[model samples]
Target: MDLIVATSAPSLVLAAGERASIRFLEFFASAIRNPHTRRAYARAAGDFLAWCASAGVASITAVQPLHVAAWIELQTQTLSAPTVKLRLAAIRHLFDWLVTGQIVPHNPAASVRGPSHTAKKGKTPVLDASEARQLLDSIDVSTPIGLRDRALIALMVFSFARVGAALAMRVDDVYVQQRRLWVRLREKGGKAHAMPCHHTLEAYLHDYLDQTGLRDEPKGPLFRTITRGTGQLSKTPLPQANAYAMVRRRAVAAGIDTPIGNHTFRATGITTYLKNGGTLENAAVMANHASTRTTQFYDRRCDDISLDEVERILL
Candidate 1:
């Protein structure tokens, strides 16, 4: 609980020390349930408070809009707009919580506006349909690791699942429903999304489960780390960093020029679907996005159309 200790520092000190500290800790430990968001927000809040302390700010209550704006200005120089915006949000939310608890008189960050940013397309590098097929076909499925990798990649691409949700799956999440293979994903915000598997994904999953005998352990992790030397799957679930590394290695082996990440498959699938007459609303539903606007970021059909138009310039 470094975050707990952070609450007691001079940056957070107020008239009632214990009460203020308790509220600060509760903001992270209780108010935010998502581990990823909790960690990120905690880092942003802690860094901002530490900077304030170094600047000779006596207490959290003394923090003013000027202090917040100055800190944000400095952050803009080094961090991207999105990163700075998220940090600002983290500070705004913490102060709002403190104000509600009577730890502070008002939210200093309330009036501050972060750098404006609007994105119509996501930055995640996507594979063309041919490259995607090549990557999947290039895997040597003789080994259990190969089968697992192929299945995991296909699951993300087909279901439009986030890497976090795909790795969080359990053996039982893949189930037979009405004679078709279906996957249940526990997406962000504790959302449960169930999608019928694409036929290719169905085949890959069947081979992986049957060959590895993971079907017997229905409660075990769906995707697992490999034990070095043994080449056997470990009981622990595959970590996101490890999955990213694996994706990079597979892309290289398949001779893919685009530098792809775990999110690439999701974007690739969405783009392919939309190009093949799929609706944006339907893609949003499948991707579990709260809004179609977020889904539109993953729709990169315009990139292809733009390239086609660019080739029309004849000298």
Candidate 2:
């Protein structure tokens, strides 16, 4: 039907005269089954709109295969191939909707190929038993904050938690029974996982809780920043950036050689378990990976490739 072009500073807003496309977009947003997917789609669409303005494609209908290709080429230099592919898919979706509404004659970039980006295949960092001990020992557990930091490191290592999941735990998420402690994790994609707290984690957590005077509050954050003056700890959950910063700061203090971040615990946990005869499937389940292949990527942490020669030398 009818097309109306509107201008914004960073975006060229193209509207359907009857408000059909806007309504369609709203409906699409509401109809999506998964909120995470819907949010990603919304971000991708927004980025595509900005790209369209930069490319001088005045309207969605005017966008061609070359325009799409040029965008992909531009993205290749700056973003990973997977990200570029996702951007293209987002643009394709908008054109598909335009075609359905008859706002465009055809989906011009319908057959455009996405950027070929492979997953990063790299060695994961690991802390041997000595290094893990050194890292724990680096924390001065005598002070209140130091005690909490020790408990945090022990909990992360034992549970193999993504730091975000660990930080999101509430006091009630931890339970003690029959001399064993357990931590309930709110994992990625809103999945809930229960992991047993090892003896070390239990001891540290016990000391931390007793020292901090955490009560039986089910909703307040489990991990909090300790105030200096009143000795008060905020109930607000720590952000992911803060989680990462904590890990990096501790790594520096411990004088770790390998590049370390919050993920180092996860990688080190998987590698350590595998070296100690734990199976790939078990690690995958422990890490909450959807596939065994994702766990396979962690095998690169082993320095020696010659270990695979076992079959050739077999009797």
Candidate 3:
């Protein structure tokens, strides 16, 4: 096979030689399938190698634990702990691959430790039940775009789906199972998760499909992009960035004060469910989480309780 080096990581090719460069490209092109993760890892690898070159590191094999540690320290000064940690992971994994391929004698980043980060609560901004309702009700469903946006947002909240999983859906993924509306999501790690839709979500989906005449196009994407100059849905799947922008615009239009994103609805739905006396285990199952601990991070009932306690400070 020919050596195919990505232009973004020119330093890797120049420092590591052709054999090592091919292994490096293979790690991203073949090993990492997820586009987002591949892009992040590529950036991390490229940045780290470029820094090494500027620091007078002679070659890729000459990099040591000290070099890795110093790079991480510099990263901590500019990036968040989680981001630094992720970059470290990317570096470590790349070296591990190189070592196994006999490009390097040992993994230099293997012994390096990333910055410590622990969080009981996630930073995703969540909305109250009333705010969520207001946002949904504010959309004018006179056009295909309106119906698409409303259905997409409702799918995330009602199904507790990640934005990626929600956008990955095909029209056939939303279908009748046992005479009730069910959604099938291809979640992280290629996990196939199916859930019966909430009544409100079912109604929104029905209206979206019926009005848009998308029910006949079962193989097409469930959420699609809108064509410019035409108020019609395109065959392309809705990009996550576009969905986020739409959510921000909708929130501002709804008079919501909280700065929310695509993830806000998922967190909001989980919090609302827990507030109404839902069990953690059940919530985990609904959210398709392998552990209740992961689901606990989305439970923002404490936010409401904290607000109530602050009211006790009477003058």
- Model 3 lDDT tens row, 1-315: 443454534564557787887887888988898889999998998899889888988888889899999999999999999999999999999988888899999999999999999999899999989999999999999999999989989998999999999999999999998999999999888899999999999999999999999889999999999999999999999999999999999999999989999999889989999999999999999999999999999999898889999999999
What does candidate 2's lDDT look like per residue over 99-152, in tens digits?
A: 776777787669888867565443456677678888888987777667767877
Displacement of the residue 223 alpha carbon in candidate 2, Å? 2.0
The global Cα lDDT (0 to 1) of model 1 is 0.92
Candidate 1, residue 315: lDDT: 96
Residue pairs in clash, model 2: none
**Leading candidate by TM-score:** 3
Error of 2 at 301 (Å): 3.9
Better of 1 and 2 by TM-score: 1
Overall local distance difference test of candidate 3? 0.91
Where does candidate 3 stray beyond 4 Å?
1-8
Candidate 1, 193-269: lDDT as tens digits: 99999999999999999999999999999999999999999898999999999999999999998999999999999
lDDT (C-alpha) at residue 276 in model 3: 92
Q: CA lDDT of each candidate? A: 0.92, 0.72, 0.91
**Worst ten in a row by lDDT for model 1:** 7-16
| Candidate 2 local lDDT, residue 16 | 32
